[model samples]
Target: MSIKITGTGSYIPNVITKNADFHQHEFYNIDGSTFPGDNESTIQKFKAITGIKERRYLDDNLNTSEMAIIAAQKAIEASGIDPETLDYIIVAHNYGDVKFNCHQSDTVPSMATRVKHHLRIKNPSCVGYDVLFGCPGWIEGLIQAQAFIRAGMAKKCLVIGAEALSRVVDKHDRDSMIFSDGAGAAVLESSEEKGGILAHESATYAYNEANYIYFGKSNNAEAPQDLRYIKMNGRKIYEFALVNVPKAMKSCLEKSGKSIKDLKKIFIHQANEKMDDAIIKRFYNLHGLDVPEYVTPMTIQELGNSSVATVPTLLDLVINGEIENQELKDGDVMIFASVGAGMNINAVVYQY
Candidate 1:
């Protein structure tokens, strides 16, 4: 049995904050720095950096788990599966659900239970677990879900990669401007064959280390700080992706007995258009493959990175037909890859 993402779902706050709105003078600093950003008129350089028009956000009021539950419920609905029947609940996070003292995130063990309760998942015996990683969380979760089902450890699972990036945004930081609160989830079940997460390969590089590449820390369980906001040596992280992603992709394909040529599409993590191009160029040189013309580069220009939820949101767009007329077919191979601050890269091969 293989694990297939039978159902896909996502949640972005209905609010549609635009890059133009960020241009308002209020967002400008007295020093002339503007977190709100520059108008499209002045910037002729990176004109079409990201085609994303807008992104969703959650008020400062909510936690990652709350957003996660919302997204998971949608997935559950789409699959028409009973929450109680879910055998495993895995949440990939860079932050906790709540303060350890009063919140569940600090002690991630409680995350699955809380999610079930939030979404009214049935029964009281489902096991809850958590996985921690940076932007690579989604792909990692997909691969793990397949393993669990294949092992018969789970019959049905709820996998989520929700991120509340807006809560941590530093209004004065241009880098943070791209961030927004968001959530994405999928209810996976045991598939006899055909669809879902078909193959996966991933590894970490302990030797190459840098700053701005670690998770937050919490002093105490009640009010955790350990898994706070994202950190990374942006420059180094990009370089790492350029080298590491290609390597990971090749290994994943080899282990699965497939190649890029066999894939109908490649769903790479949407970090930035520049990064996308860098990886695209790398792909051409190594495997002689170019990202299919119909591939979706969903990263938002002003919408900051949303970590784990990135790929799934793109997947949701595809299933919902938001991806538009494209060249993907029912049995095409699609690869999802991610390289994050941890100096870790994950690559998964899927039959979509």
Candidate 2:
């Protein structure tokens, strides 16, 4: 069984955050870690060091659910599927509505359950839930949706990767400046087609010590603290991506009986411009193509890092002409890869 992506859509808040924007914000360190900068431009070296330009974000009037709602609506229109016909709607959100309408904390179901009500999804019986994963959440949910579609459990599934990363950013930290808020959606439907998520594979590196790179779990003890803001150890994440991401991409390609040469395009994760640069430099020499030549590197400096939202958002950007020269077309093999804070990395192969 195969799943066809009938439609694709994405959203980034109107608020654009540049290096200057972050510098203007206050810096607070409850743990007493000295924040090392005065203004945004002073940290321009850090951006150059990290290789990011800018990232998009939502201002006061915005939040993750709102972005997700916008993207999902666009995806519904692109998919040509009425919202009411949806059988399952799964959101890959680190924290969509942290500043809830009433409550202090946000739960997966709390926001996901309302997609139908808010969008007036035609079928209220459709199951809508949130799948909690780090940066790799999009691919993971995609695989699950494929299973549901194959088993006849769902006629159509609307999967969204939305993250409100700024809510948790340690503003004073320079390494955290790249995080942002955005949303992306893809509609999966049963298909007899050959392409579209032909092979999906993943790997995890759970180093006992490095696990601290990106680690936050909901205590659910009494009040769920700020578990939604994505965090990371930038240096450690870079190491993990350099070592494991290439191997994971290979593992997925091998599963499909293909190699890097056969791929028309590899849509690697867009967390940073450097990761793709390192991958191409280490893996294969994409002749006549730059490392980021095929990649839609979403600049984290402005939008911040939207965690799981990065890859899919970039994908939609390509489709919508936001990305130059290259756009998504049929028979293109895209490799999805991500390195989250838990020192976790996952790679999957999807052919579109």
Candidate 3:
């Protein structure tokens, strides 16, 4: 038996925020000092490094759980599965649901419970829970689902990654422009298929990197003493990812009994274009191979970094033929990888 991703779905918000939108906003350094140079030059440098021209933000009326519900519905529909038959519902996220202009994160009932409730699944045995593993959360959710199936604890599961990052960002911080809001989901089930998830690798380097990404007071020091927003040490994260992520991916692929040449595509977290490009190059170098053209499909150029939502969202788009020149075919070998807060990193070697 194999655990296969039977269906995939994603919710890309309708609100398009262009880079030019920040041109008039005040930018500040992490130490609350005035940002050097003007907004145009700042944005240009940002674009050159990250390749993000625009991003999507959740509408004011919707929250992260609501977006999860939508993506879950689509996945359920695509899978043609009865909602009541699901054995587990896993929602991955960082900040629960932060209402527009609200600083508090609502996770009392848990995002998974909220999704199951909104999906209207009445089965009491369909356990619902949340996983807080940072941007790799969704991929981690998939790994968990596979474990449950392999252990005979579940037959079918729904895994979702959703976030309203726009609501958690500090406008005064330039990194705020790198964040957006979205959700993605997939249905996993045990099947007699020959190829599915072959292997996975996960790690947390919190000893010295625990604070690479964290919540801190806004760049505007005088804004509030008690309130905090999502923040990160960009240079630290980039350096850390380059050193560690490729090794994890290589380990996973090796465990799958597959060679580097077998990989058809790589679905990596949409954090930064340059960072991802560097990771992929290093990944191939480990195998003494050159990076293949179009081996990686990216949505980051338009969708920005939506944390947990990036990998699954990219998979959903490619599988549905929404991304030009990128397609997933049966019998294709692929790698899914991500790195984020918790100083965490994970990779899954899957056969489509």
Better of 1 and 3 by lDDT: 3
**TM-score for all predictions?**
0.82, 0.85, 0.99
**Candidate 3, residues 9-106: lDDT per residue as tens digits?**
99999999999999998999988899999999999999999999999999999999999999999999999999999999999999998988889999
Which of 2 and 3 is the better model by lDDT?
A: 3
| Model 2 stretches with alpha carbons more than 4 Å out | 24-42, 100-103, 122-124, 207-210, 214-230, 285-302
Estimate the overall C-alpha local distance difference test score of candidate 3. Answer: 0.96
List, residue by residue over 1-352, the lDDT tens digit for candidate 1: 6667778788766656666555532332323344244545422323354444455676656677887888898898899887888888888767655432232235434555678777776665687777776778877877777787888778898888877766554333344445666778888888777666666888877675535475443222333334354444556777788887877877787777776667666677777667767776686568866656665445455344677887777777677876556445677788888877566689888876
Model 1 residue runs over 4 Å out of place are 24-53, 97-109, 215-229, 297-304, 326-328
Question: Which sequence of candidate numbers ranks them by TM-score, best first?
Answer: 3, 2, 1
Candidate 1: RMSD over Cα atoms? 5.3
Judging by TM-score, tell me the better candidate of 1 and 2: 2
Q: For residues 93-141, what per-residue lDDT tens digits would candidate 2 score against the true structure?
A: 7655756233334665555676656788766668888877677887777
Q: Candidate 1 at residue 40, lDDT?
A: 55
Question: TM-score: which candidate is best?
Answer: 3
Residue 270 Cα positional deviation in candidate 3, in Å, after optimal superposition: 0.2
Best by lDDT: 3
**Backbone collisions counted per model:** 22, 16, 0
